[model samples]
Target: MLTIIPDLPDHIFGLRASGEVTKDDLQQVLLPGLEKLSEQYKEIYYLLVLETDVRNFTAGAWVQDLIAGIKHLTEWKKMAIVTDQKAVEKFTDIFSYLSPGEAKGYKLTELPIAIGWLSHKA
Candidate 1:
């Protein structure tokens, strides 16, 4: 399941996930939000909080996320992934340069700080 984190500024989009995420979740929740943000802003700051209960993403969902990122490559300004999983942290650190803008991985406990850093323009 995925739930939006409300009360953020217009340029930031936040979500918290739990359990196994499927392709439909991306289609139903993420896609619409991304489209809306694209219509309103030149760039978006995405914050994804991967809770411990969030086990993993289905293969199709993972693929969908990849496709979505590629499809909106230039629209992403910053991506902050809050996950305690070592693998996720390592992967983000390794591939951060691949992002169109900046990318950072943080522990779940540091979510607020991550948001602050991503929202910082300079």
Candidate 2:
């Protein structure tokens, strides 16, 4: 399941992912928020918290994610992925350089700090 974490700073877009995520979850729960934020802001700060190891993503969801990232390439301001999973952390570290703004990974215990970092101006 993918859950939206509300009440973040106006420019921060937050999501908590648990269990398995499907294309429907991305389409139904996540896309609308991104669309709304895009309308209001030129750039977006993103916080993705992996509450549990993702069981897996459906093939369609993987494609959707790629499409969204490409479509919003320049709109990303900063991105923080909070997860205890080592592979996830490394994945973020490896690809972070591709971001126009800062990108980092944090342990789950550091979620508060991640939120602060995302909300802060760079």
Candidate 3:
């Protein structure tokens, strides 16, 4: 499931992923939200909180993710992935430079900090 995190600044987009993530979640929730944000802001500030393991994500969900990323290859300003997995967190931090914009990983406990970072773009 993919849940939208609300009450964020208009320039920031947030989502929470839990349980079995499906392509439907991406298509119905993520894609529309992203497209809406893209229209309102010049650069996207995406915050994703992962409550489930990546293994739980359906293959189609991964494909949707790749497609979305490619579509916004140069449209993001910052991205923050909040997860409890240490390996995933570390890897996201190290490989973020290759992403379109500045990307970072934070432990779940640091979600507030992540939101702050995303909003300020620093």
Top candidate by TM-score: 3
Clashing pairs in 2: none
As for TM-score, the candidate ahead, 2 or 3, is 3
Q: What TM value does model 1 have?
A: 0.92
> Scored by CA lDDT, what does every candidate get?
0.83, 0.85, 0.90
Between candidates 1 and 3, the one scoring higher on lDDT is 3
Q: List model 2 lDDT by residue over 7-105, tens digit each.
A: 899888899988888899889877887787778987778889987775577788788888778878888878899999988888888778877767889
Model 3 collision count: 0
Per-candidate clash tally: 0, 0, 0
Tens-place lDDT digits, model 3, residues 7-100: 9988888999999999999999999988998988867899999999999899999999999999988897888999999888888888687886
| Tens-digit lDDT string for candidate 1 (1-122) | 77888987678889888888889989888888888888888677888898844447888888889888998998888888899897887777777788777788899889889989877752
Query: How close to the true structure is residue 56 of candidate 2, measured as C-alpha lDDT?
Result: 71
Candidate 3 residue-wise lDDT at 71:
94
Native-to-model Cα distance after best TM-score fit, residue 83 in candidate 3, in Å: 0.7
* lDDT of model 2 at position 110: 94
**What C-alpha RMSD separates each model from the true structure?**
1.6, 1.2, 1.0
Query: What is the full ranking by lDDT, best candidate first?
Result: 3, 2, 1
